[model samples]
Target: MNHLDHGTEVNPIKSNTKSIITDHNKDDHNAQEVKAIVRGPIPAAAVPDHMWQAVIANDRAYDGQFFYGVTSTRIFCRPSCKSRPPKKEHVFIFQHAEQALQAEFRPCKRCKPTGVRLPEQEWIDIVKTYIDDHYASPVTLNTLADISHSSPYHLQRTFKRLMGISPNAYVQEVRIQHAKERLRGTKESIADIGAKVGMDNVSYFVTLFKQKTGMTPSAYRENKASNTMNDVCTPD
Candidate 1:
């Protein structure tokens, strides 16, 4: 299978789905729900019966664990899901949204994976969309807060809390990725790519690029170009 088209290693732990949807809230069914899951490093050790009991008592056991953001429906469910379980073999688990997106998983409208709090996810969603659309433009927390209709402090914390990264850092990463994409695919000059990504100084942009990617913009372009030539000459 093509590695680009296949996502095997990231697949979630599978569970036999005797039943899918349950009427009980996950809290009420904690005992069985916890039993259904294996936390920490999988295949290393099975979760003990008492360990599951403890998880039943404390609902936050899966806080840092990888979870699958199923794309067919707008929901991010745990690997050990018993309620309305998706096909055991078809699920993907991610450590966070970054990995989920890397695997082409979209945000779930139902569970709202980004925002774990009530009424907060919607606000964060708007802010994230704004950032994605305008990442190339120079953004300040104040401007973002104004558009988000929230305070700068709130925006900063909420973004960090939900996205697992700061808004500024997210913007920078996006700009860098966008610039790299352009650099690889377009005939744009280095200065133009920098300008497109909202960097005023091309030299500064090169510095940021090197810091993040361990290579200058020109160096990266050359590498991509060489690889392209090699691929073109390789046997079919």
Candidate 2:
């Protein structure tokens, strides 16, 4: 009776097990389809022609559809970014913001494709800090823009608006301040000091120092020395 029971039930059990396995396989296939739809397109896939046209036209309708990165600037932007259009050859398309970033492209400060907006004051502060650190070198609007990940026009406008002076003026002020310190504390020649502060032309340096301080470097040094001596002699 035990042998008969085992033989009679084995086929039915095998049929039920196969049915369950088939259902699981169907569920897995459906899950993969859903994941593929959510992930959008593969980044390595060839860019569709319509995407390029959308970028050129600055089409806001396609903004979430794709992103384009400029190889020249290494910056990625949404289709709706209003900055100057990049050359066709320099642009690479990505299906998502994260894909562009993963490819080493920084999100555009203008469009902010990553949805994080850096505060204007904070951006200006970063520019100022860079200038302070590199004032002894030639700092131009283009160089600052490149380092700060912004356009030169925007950088100039924002920096001047917040700092009360243009970037070039700020650079001159920094250099002159350093020149003044060297003049009072060190015996370096005026020409050498000028060069050390990034103004290599002796004539131009003297002219600029007088313009900024209302006295030549030599006169300023002399005045400082005179004041120090008088203070020492009249000590309480």
Candidate 3:
């Protein structure tokens, strides 16, 4: 029944309590955000000393994290480059290969700081060959980058640009093709067949097979068998 000048009744105690709760929630959220910012990854450029040590050690772990351009040679290299380390005073760290290139530094032929600078077809050929050779093994972007001597980011972009499909999708296609051949020619168990094709998880393999071929591996094998029988029975 009580009303203020604007003609609206208010509970002062409840209103005050809600304001306090809202302030407390805001404070808690801000504290969490501060903690997250503090715990975030430190960018490679912030730690030149650590990067220097990585380069000196030829640590593969630091390969794509940063590159060091040597003023003496005007060349940039990944931290894991096998070439001899440049003098510390003459080296400058760059967060990306483009940054070094912008500074007029050419990519080191040894470390290949600027990936895929070769002829586009040559780069694609190298990637495709690596994929074909390692189709039966576990091939991931990082592994492919290491094998192909490029950053995972650059390798993925280049591969998708030229191949019309992501590298992983290409690997899946290769695996499925191999699986089909094995299914038609061999009497191997389904799980064994999957493992032979680099899909160790049988269920995942079955799922992928069905997705790719519109039928399960068992069904595909049965269809092949039925076709073989029909061919044998036919006079032609």
Q: Which candidate's TM-score is highest?
A: 2
Ranking by TM-score: 2, 3, 1
Instruction: Tell me the tens digit of each residue's lDDT in model 1 across 1-236.
Output: 65465555542333223223342345446545543553322221343444333223333445445455433332454433333434333444455655665565554433345554336776687667878888778888876765554578878998899889988888889889998999899989999999999897999999999999999999999899999999999998
- Error (Å) of candidate 2 at residue 194 is 0.8
User: How would the candidate models be sorted by lDDT, starting from the highest?
Assistant: 2, 3, 1
Over the stretch 1-236, how does candidate 2's per-residue lDDT look in tens digits?
45444454467888999999999887666445434443543332455566667787998866676788887656788889887777777787776888887887777787899998867886677678778888888889888887566789989999999999999999999999999999999999999999999899999999999999999999999999999999999959
Poorest 10 consecutive residues of model 1 by lDDT? 38-47
Please give the CA lDDT of all the candidate structures: 0.64, 0.81, 0.77
In the range 97-120, model 3's lDDT, one tens digit per residue, is 777878876676556777745565
* Candidate 2 TM-score to native: 0.56
Q: TM-scores for all candidates?
A: 0.50, 0.56, 0.54
Q: Kindly indicate the candidate among 1 and 3 with the higher TM-score.
A: 3
> Which sections of candidate 2 miss by over 4 Å?
1-113
Q: How does model 1 score by TM-score?
A: 0.50
Model 3 spans with C-alpha error above 4 angstroms: 1-116
